[model samples]
Target: MTSLIIGVLLVVGGAMVGIALDRSLLRRWIRNRDPRRHHPAPETRAASSRRRSARHAIEDAERRVESAEAGQLSAETAASRVEASLDALQAGLVLCDRNGRVVAQNTAATQFLQARHGEALVAPVIKDLLEQARSGELVTTRVELHAEPRRSYEVRAGPVERGGEMLGAVALVHDITEHDRIESVRRDFVANVSHELKTPIGALSLLADSLAADSDPEVAAHLAGRMQIEIQRVANTIDDLLTLAMLEDESGRPGARVDVGAVVAAAVDRISETAEQNDVKVVLSNRTAATAIRGSRLHLESAVFNLLDNAVKFSESGGRVDVVVEADQQALTVSVTDEGIGIPATEQSRIFERFYRVDRARSRSTGGTGLGLAIVRHVALNHGGDVSVTSREGFGAKFTVTLPLDSGD
Candidate 1:
C-alpha cells in the first residue's frame, strides 16, 4: 500500500508541472503576436518596439512617394501651360545655352528659318554673338536677309541671368524695312531742298552784282530783268516748299467743296494765255457735269493749272492739248493729254521728284521751276488721291489724277 501511494503522488506532480509550462509558452506566443502585449524582460520589449517602428516608417515612406508623384504631375502641367502661352505670341523667341546651342524656339522662329532658306532655326549664325551676350554685351545691329522677297531686320542681343549667375542669351529680331525706306526718303528730300534753294540764291546774287557794276542803261536794264526772273524763281520755290510742308502736316484743316466745273474753267482760262504764248492749241472735253471735289480752292486750282501749263510748255507749235474732267460715284479723274516730246522711260519715274527735270535745258527754256509736278503729287496725296503718268518716247504723254469722292456726299 505505501509503494502505490508514492506512485500516484509522483504522477500528479508531473501533470501539474507540464500544465504550467504549456501556459507559459501560450503567454509568450501572445506577447510576440499582439502589438499591445508587454514583456517582463526589458530587452525583449525594446526589440519588439523597434520592429513596430520600422514597419510604420516603411509605410510612411510609401505614402510620401505617392504624394510626390502627384506634386510632380502638377508641376509638369503648369510648365506645359507656360510653354503653350509663349507659343501663341507673334514675335519670334529663342532660348539658348551659353554655348549658343538651341534649347527652345517659338513658331515664328520656325517660319523665319523656313523663309531664310532652311537655315537651322534658333541656332546662332555666329557663336561669338552668344558669347558676347553671355558676357553682358547689349549689342544691336541691322541685318539684311536675302530671304524670299528680301527683308531688313534689326537684331538686338542681351544676356539672360538668374541669381547673379549667367544663364544664356536672347536675340530679338524686328522688321525695319519700312522705317529704313522712310529714313532714306527723308535724307534725299533734305539734299534736294538744299540744292534747289542754293541755285536760285546764287543766280540772284550774280545778277544783282552785275546790275550794280554795269553803268550802261541797256546793260543794267538787262541785268535787272535777269535778277527779277531769279527772284520770281525763288518765290515760286518758296511757295512750293510751304505748300508741301502744309500738306505733310498731320493736322486736319478744313477745305471748301469747290465746283469741279468752275475749277476746270478757271484752269483753262489760266492756261489759255500760256498755250497761246507757246503756240499750242488747248481743247477741253467736259464729260461729267456738276462734278465737285473737296479740297482747298487754291490747291485744286494750282494743281490743275500746273498740269495744263506742263502740257502747253511741252507741246509743239499747233499741237493739240486735251483736258478732261470726269467723275463717277467712287472717284473723280482729271486727265491732261499732250502731244509733246514725250519723257524717256528712264526719266519718267523721277519726274515727280522735287527739282528733278527730264531735260534741264528745255526746262530752263520753258521757265519751269521743276516743282510743278511735285506740287501736284503732294496735293493729290493730301486729298487722299494719287497721280500717274504714261508717256511713250517721242509720241505723247498723259497725266491722270484720281481723287476719292467725299464719303458723306
Candidate 2:
C-alpha cells in the first residue's frame, strides 16, 4: 500500500509542473500580441515620428499658400492705385526708363503729343532733353509749333534718382501759347497809346504858336477858338482813356439793381441836346420797362447813353434813331438802330477796338471820340452781356446789347 501511494504522488507532481509551464507561456503570448505593451518596438516608434513630421509639413505648406495669395492681391491693388494717380494729373507727364524708353504716359500726354502731328514734331525734342537730363541735370526745351491754332509747347525734364542713384527720367509738358499772346497784346497797347497821345499834343503846340504870332482881332479870335477845340479834344481823349482803365477793374461793373426802361429813358434825356444839334430824331420804344436787372445804375446809364450818342452822331440830318428795350427769360436786349451810313463789312469787326475809327474825317468833324464803341463794348462785357452789330454798307446800322438775366430772378 505504501509503494502505490508513493507512485501516485510522483505523477500528480509532474502533471502540476506541466500545467504551470503552459499558463506562463500563454501570458507571454498575450503580452506580445497586444500593441499597447509597456515597451514598444523600435520600428513602431520610428513610423509614428515620421507620420507626425509629414502632417506638420503639409500644414506649413497650406499656410505659405494663403500668405502668397494675399501678397499677390496686395501688390495688384497697389499697382492699380499708382496707375490711377498718375492719370489724374492735368499736366502732361511722361516717365522713361534708364535707357530713355517711354515706360508710362498719362492721358494729357497722349493728347498733347497727338494734336496735329505734335508727336512727330516733339519726339526729337523729348529724346534730346532726356539725353541731356541723364547727366543728373534739369534740362528744358521749348518748341514753337506753327499749326492751325499756332501753339507753343515747353518740355522740361529731369533725372529721377533714388539714394544717389539715377533710375530714370520724368518730363513735364506745358502749353505756353496764351502767355505769348498776352505779351504781344501788351506791346501793341503801349505803341498805340504813344501814337494817340502824340497827335493831339503836336496839334496843340502848332495852334499855340499861331495864336501867339497873330495880331488881328478876327484872326486871334479864330486862332483862339481853334486852340479851344484842340484842347477839348485832348481832354475828351484823356477822359476816355481813364474810363477804359477803370473799366478793366471788377469794381467798375454793375453792383445794384437797375430798371431797364428808366435806364434807357435817362440815356435818351442825356443825349437829347446832342441829338438836336445833329438834327437827328431819336424815338424811344420801352417794351421792357417793368423788367429789373442787377448792376450799377450809373454804369447802365452811361452804357445806354454812349450807344444812343453813337447813333445820333452818325445819323444824317432828319434821320431817325430808334432805341428799343426788350427782354426774354434768359436776357434783356437794348437795340439802337440808326438811319445812317452803315459800316463797311471789312471794317466792322475792328469798330470796338479803342481809338479805331471807320471814317476818321467824319469823327473829327463831329467832335466825336473814337472810344465810344470801345466803352460800349466794355460796359456790355462787365455787365455779363455782349454787344453785336448788324449792317450793310451805306444802308443802316444796328447795335444790340444783350445782358444776361439774373439767376435770382
Residues 42-90, model 2: lDDT tens digits: 9889999999999999999999999999999999999899888878876
Give one digit per residue, the lDDT tens place, for model 1 in 176-275: 7778766866787787678667877899888888887879999998888888888887787788888766766735524668776688789999899889
RMSD list, candidates in order: 8.2, 7.8
The number of clashing residue pairs in each candidate reads 0, 2
Query: What local lDDT score does residue 64 receive in model 2, on the 0 to 100 scale?
Result: 97
RMSD (Cα, Å) of candidate 2?
Answer: 7.8
lDDT of 1: 0.77
Pairs that clash in candidate 2: 254-296, 255-296
User: How do all models score by TM-score?
Assistant: 0.68, 0.69
